[model samples]
Target: MKDTIKYVGLDVSKEKIAVAIAEEGREEPRYYGLIPHTTEAIKKLLKKLGEPSALRVCYEAGPTGYPLYRLLLSLGVHCDVIAPSLIPKRPGERIKTDRRDSIRLAHLYRAGELTSIYVPTPEDEALRDLVRAREDAKEDELRLNIA
Candidate 1:
């Protein structure tokens, strides 16, 4: 089972995604650069990862929502969406870059320190979207009244 387990960490942004791959006992993790944060890009990434047998993928739950989580599930890759704040911070870690974030995610995941967020389904996502839209519309109305 040790040989079959592969850990992948993704640092996702609106434009690009930084990926890091690590396996148990591997000295250094492999870093992959900016992949577009689109469905097509996600598909391509899963393909590049090869067969997903016993592979675990993790990413921080950011503004991107759960599209990647759902996509990975469809591709048979076990994925975890974790809260960004739940991850442990390194002391004096001033450099907050995507590459470094990805590396840190990989290391933390390997160390079993990541806490996953609850992944919502398609229906749940639709409901959430509706609620958000309604809130936005209400806020707009308030702004208009103030104006």
Candidate 2:
């Protein structure tokens, strides 16, 4: 009974999520296909992937936010919110697709080349949103001369 680690990479969008997995060793990572952006689908995928303790998940930080990361954490799985801009890129690699991105992420993450960002707390997010809204309102007021 050896403890094997599975590095899972997710390319997340509003409607669907593309998954890839890199198991321990030098083998190439494999695409795990796409799943709907829903709790049930995600839970089912995790169940099929195997034990939570063996899974290490990561996805780029975008408008999708940290809900998925929080969910994985709650499920006792190790998860990381990747900094997309910091991910290493190959020269002239212009062809981009969800499948390719997921595979690349899994490979890079397994090689310790990906940088993870801080996951803000729910309260911190709320306060940041509030400040942004106030700033927008002030800018709007100035533009319309409605001080």
Best by lDDT: 2
RMSD of each: 2.7, 1.3
Tens digits of per-residue lDDT for model 1, 10-124: 9999889999887777557778777988888888877777678667899999888887888888888899998888888879889888998887787778778999988888899
- Please, what are the lDDT tens digits per residue for candidate 2 over residues 19-126? 999999999999999999999999999999999999999999999999999999999999999999999999999999999999999999999999999999999999
Q: In model 2, where do residues sit more than 4 Å from their true spots?
A: none
Worst 10 residues of 2 by lDDT: 138-147
Q: TM-score for every candidate vs. truth? A: 0.82, 0.96
lDDT of 2 at 6: 98
